[model samples]
Target: MTVTIRDASLADLSVIASIYADAVLTGTASYEIVAPDETEMKKRFQSVTSQGYPYIAAVDESGDVLGYAYASAFRTRPAYRWLVEDSIYLAPAARGKGIGRLLLAELVARCEALGFRQMVAVIGGASPASIAVHQACGFRMVGTLTGTGFKLGQWLDTVFMQIALGDGNASEPDPESYPGTLFAG
Candidate 1:
């Protein structure tokens, strides 16, 4: 089946919220089992687009949000502007059908369009599928923070994966010197 990838708007937050909450409550895909409600989800969606980061959704016919991806600051410090962290989530039945791959590929493209120089993916240790997905998307394993994330009465380890897209010969840009404004509280 061919899925169309498009920029997610504020109107699409409900379905994106459901997908995220589904992963949080019923799946080990994310370590956080505390699923957020629609209000919180709306804020998350708003934050992504408001900051000029692409919040993309994969939709089947009839515009159902089967999955989504977005990027956010890798670190708050001025040095990290070119570095962004990524998130991809798919509906349960949509798994293993190239939905994740499509969203991730689109995410990298969008981030690059926004002048991002690198991407970092933080995956729960239990999600080898996610790890493999990012690896297949050109991310390399960097390190692991053992027993760092706690959820569902258990501590989960986090694996860090990174991809560098910057021109290797260029000097690092000072994040604060950039004229772009970022949405932050």
Candidate 2:
């Protein structure tokens, strides 16, 4: 099965929402309980695209969405302008293939091209695949928040993994800009 990665469109929102909702509702991939609708996802896609970020999907030649990945503002502040947070989700039946990797590779390329200097993957500890994949892609586990999330009637851990896309290590962030303020409310 050949998997192709490409830019996601508004029409792909339903499939994306289905895959995301499946991951959220059934699997331990995400911690949210209320599954978002297509309308909500479409708005999300639009927001990301409008901001020049990447929202990519892996699909078969027949145009079926196998999985999706995206990079969004890590923090809204101008000081955090170089940073982004990412997410990847695959269709229930589409796991175990390299689809997630393909989707993320595209997102990384676009994020870097957009001049993003850092990318973070804040992942659920239950998804070892996510952790391993990000590691293979060069993201390091920077922090772990034990019991930061509650899901499936149990406390869930959140892991913070990150990679630097640019050269210098920024020790001092600009104080005037509040982090995570870039996304329009």
Candidate 3:
């Protein structure tokens, strides 16, 4: 399957919502107990894109969305402006086909190009597959919070993996050129 990664559009939200809903319903990647509807997804999409964050989708040759990924502020505070967090979700058929890796790589490149210095992956449930994909994209295991989440009738751990983008912390960010709307006062 030829998969292309591109900026997500409003038309893609339906499929994106489906993909995320499935993940929330059946997988531990997302902690939400109830899958959100398309309206809610639209609000989230607007929130991310409005802030100039990179929200992307992986589409098949026929123009079907197979998966999606995006980078959002790790925290809304001004002090964390240079840091962003990544989230990725794939359709059931898209798993294990390296789609996650592709989405993550593209997301990383886009974030770096935008001048983000650090990208963090907060892997809910500490999913092995998620961890491996992040590792393949040059993220390193930072720490794991055991029993941090409870779902599916059991306790789950949350893993933290991080990668340096651009110059990372080796040099200071140019205060004159903050990336995106994240630095808006």
- Clash number by candidate, in order: 0, 7, 0
lDDT of 1: 0.80
On lDDT, the leading prediction is: 3
Tens digits of lDDT, candidate 3, 1-185: 89999999999999999999999889899999999999999999999999989999999999999999999999988889999999999999999999999999999999999989999999999999999999999999999999988888889999999999999999999976676786786
Q: Model 1, range 110-162, lDDT digits (tens) per residue?
A: 77766778889988755788988898899899998888777767777888998
**Residue range 69-177, candidate 2, lDDT tens digits:** 9888877776577788999999978888877777777787777666677899989854789988888788888998888888888888888988886442565433443
Task: Give the range of the ten consecutive residues with the poorest summed lDDT in model 3.
Answer: 176-185
| Candidate with the greatest TM-score versus the true structure | 3
Q: Which residue pairs clash in candidate 2? A: 75-180, 76-180, 76-181, 76-182, 77-178, 77-180, 77-181
The total number of steric clashes, by the backbone 3 Å criterion, in model 1 comes to: 0
Q: Scored by CA lDDT, what does every candidate get? A: 0.80, 0.81, 0.95
RMSD of 3: 0.7
Better of 1 and 3 by lDDT: 3
RMSD of each: 2.6, 3.6, 0.7
